[model samples]
Target: MVVIHDGYFTDVEGCIKENWFQIDSLLAKQILCRFSLPFNKLAIFTLYNNCVHLSAICILINLFHIYILTRKALRTTSPIYILLTAIAMIDIVSLSYDIHTEIVEVYKVFKVCYSKETDYTIILLNNIMEFIRNYSRRCSTWLSFSIALIRTLIVKYPLNPKLEILSKPKIAFYIIPTILILSAPIHFMDIYKYQIVFYDENFKCTQFPSYTTLYYGSILSDYYEQDDVWLWKLNRTIDAVISKFIPCILFPIVTYLLVIEIRLADERRKKLNQSSIAEKDSKNTTKLVLFLTLPFFLGELPIGLILLTKPIDKLREAIGFSLFTEGIEKFFSVVLSATTATHMIVCVFMSSQYRESALSFIRCGVKFKSQNS
Candidate 1:
């Protein structure tokens, strides 16, 4: 979601065309130097053009699949199914947040007439949006990681009765809530780091004396001055280290270990005269984990690195590098959104039961439509 903020100022037509959208002279100078044009606008336009409709359709499809998956998981009391259902639910929430924020942002960019009160409300909403976006995104990540961990346990400890208890829907319900509650505190840092500022009769919402502003002047300068600036920076560094960097490193390691365990189990099964139903289920779960994890790793790792680096003006000074970084950010936003949106499709392909349920649901719909006609 922070990635999407790069394009938030693209609608400043004055800044783009005539450099007339004055905030504070210092702020304007920092903005003009750091925030480039056409690329941001193009990224925003391209997102609306391509991702908006696709995301809407995917959300619908995801809801349908989530319904089927939830029913199946509850009926079967399958941990893997429950985890998949949880992932689907989180994806839906994340996608909804993205859609809502994008719509609000587009309105701010093109339609809303800025008033002091209106700007205040928008800024508040933006902060709330960032909170939800980060919260849901982290929840989604942890849920996926949980899936991989559960599957690894299943593969490695097939005979453990205690581990089998994890498959129960009641246990899954507990796990989901526990994950959500634990991850909530990490994102409180985001709320502290961002706030609304009013300048030159216009309200702007941004990080306190953002990297660009700090680059242009000392921390004590008129526009860049904020008593809590160091605290905010400290919080951001801690957040990046704990939330982004740790997970980025740990997820891949866990995934790799899961893959190895799954493979070893497969080989053991081959030596047997017959594989148990649980063994078969483990294989399917492994496949699903691979599908989900690949997209998450590819999409999130670079975004994490970008956030961790927090490119300063010196780094951004390279010719075309700023635009390039913006493009990378936008590109991964699409990837992450697409990955979340198409999750049901991944499940449908990876699990025969899901595919069959989907087909049956479609048939029922068709029959109902024909009867109505």
Candidate 2:
């Protein structure tokens, strides 16, 4: 999603105006025509399937939560369960947005002829895409960390009533708004490529931002130039510290804390081990954490390694190696998707409690339909 600026920013800076919208259907058709370009359809197909799988998994998670809410016996004051439900809901909404982009609109509009004015609809769509992309990145990072934190709390302080503060519903409600506020700065980031521009009857959006090529094409040059070097370094350093360093540090620490808590409980409670229910619960809980956390760690490693090697630019222009990079990205996305899907499968397959509850809900719906018939 990075851009390389070849000073097109200067040529178009004077053309940008606030409160303007443009949609060129002719341009959209032209863009989609490139689908005929010699590219790997297999890779594209894999990406499409990955997107569908992710969307379906998320939708199922949402359905599971609705089922949970239907079960009075299973309903409790347990904060952990509430947190899981909220996380599922968030994942569902985010995944739906992603699927909409891929299947519903690849940002293409076809018009038999060009309209003189910019399309307001496309402008609105562009803004919405920018907002969702920026905010979702921030939200997903924080939510995953929050989940890790909740698990650590449950394992570490099982009997501590004060641990109620980490309750799922409370944290879920609070964190959603907190993520929104934290991402407020994103509205001002303006660090996007392919922005709408107009100049002297030539109306089009350029991949590089007008008047600021430094933030566009070629990751290295985007943040590094002999001119304006300090601003670039400052921005790069901030991005590195927050995006790269914080998540890297936090995920591991929280994961380690969860592991230690589980071990401590296991060692301190030999009497409890005799109870089959306790042991089964403990094993399932451990599996849940391990299955979810492992992919995230694996996915994190490659990006971190690439950063350390200063390979962003090379990877971007890696024509010969581009396929390799794309493979790794697709693989990681699949790993994450598989892990998420496993969580849903666990709800139905491993947990008899959840399975029974889910089935009863389905049966009730069947009965209602039969009665109406």
Candidate 3:
């Protein structure tokens, strides 16, 4: 059992001292005497392996996007096409730091660095992680908002009546600004609220500070005063509404309405001029919306309910939905994967034009390499 001090776990200094001494005496010597060089080499290999794996995947995805946009043969200049690129760009940017950070942390794991500079790196990395988190959350909100608004417009107003007027990037003009404005509040989430914990083999970060730990530490005890507690609860409540329920409800309703409008439009078009292609397009759109959005709704519901209600039953339900039985760390990862998968699937599947372009690009590159040989 340990106490708390300032904003950190109490006795952390002593704990770190004991751990470092143990590392130096037991693990360090053993590692050095038997397999130090080989171990270091292996760590480097693993680091490179992970970096290359992530970087390569990102490159491939981006290359595919580029191919689709550039290819004249499959030029699809639709609002949905633009949305796909926007989502891909977000993923690429988010992944750029994420992959590198993972690689760096993995490398550090083999040879731990606990100096002031290490702390700085940790701070920088933590901030980047936070930025990525907020950025991703904002992206999700915006994506849903955009799609919902688009569907709303298409359902509310047919394009044929005002075809020329609606073609001027209606979605981008409105949704972009709304998302930017709505996401502004997230920047206020400071690093000071939570203390980082190094436990077991890896450091497990927690959003909620242990009350016992906080009470022991003056800084944390002061930080977690009644006012702060209320604020935190309020913020959590706001997040539940803004990030989860609103988007979940709005997206489905808008999508349903849009589907109905599409069906109606198809019927009208068929009566006017029988075209199987238009019918196929409507079916594809319906499928695309359902496939992309259902996972998000499923993933968020349990977590959102738990957070909002905080009932034991609800919390247990959320835990059941969690991917791993390993506790909070695994829970966070599960939620993240589930949420991001929605965006990823939508971006990839929505634009068939992009896929064709990407495949052709890959083939050409392989051909060029073969010819060089």
Best TM-score among the predictions, by candidate number: 1
Question: Of models 2 and 3, which has the larger lDDT?
Answer: 2
lDDT on C-alpha atoms for all candidate structures: 0.63, 0.50, 0.49
Error of 3 at 302 (Å): 3.3
Which pairs, if any, clash in model 1?
A: none
In candidate 3, list every pair of residues with a backbone clash: 3-10, 4-10, 4-217
Pairs of residues at least 3 apart in sequence or in different chains that clash in candidate 2? 3-216, 3-217, 4-217, 22-118, 22-119, 23-119, 79-168, 83-168
- Cα lDDT for residue 111, model 3? 47
- Candidate 1 Cα lDDT to native: 0.63
In candidate 2, how many Å is residue 296 off?
2.8
Q: Write the per-residue lDDT of candidate 2 for residues 282-355, one digit (tens) a residue.
A: 55555565555555565444544433433344533433234334444445544544444445565554444555
lDDT of 1 by residue, 54-155 (tens): 667768877886788876533385676777678777777767765776687687557434455665676577567657867887888778777777777766
Better candidate number, 1 or 2, judged by TM-score = 1
Better of 1 and 3 by lDDT: 1
RMSD of each: 9.2, 12.0, 12.7
Taking all chains together, the TM-score of candidate 2 against the true structure is 0.62
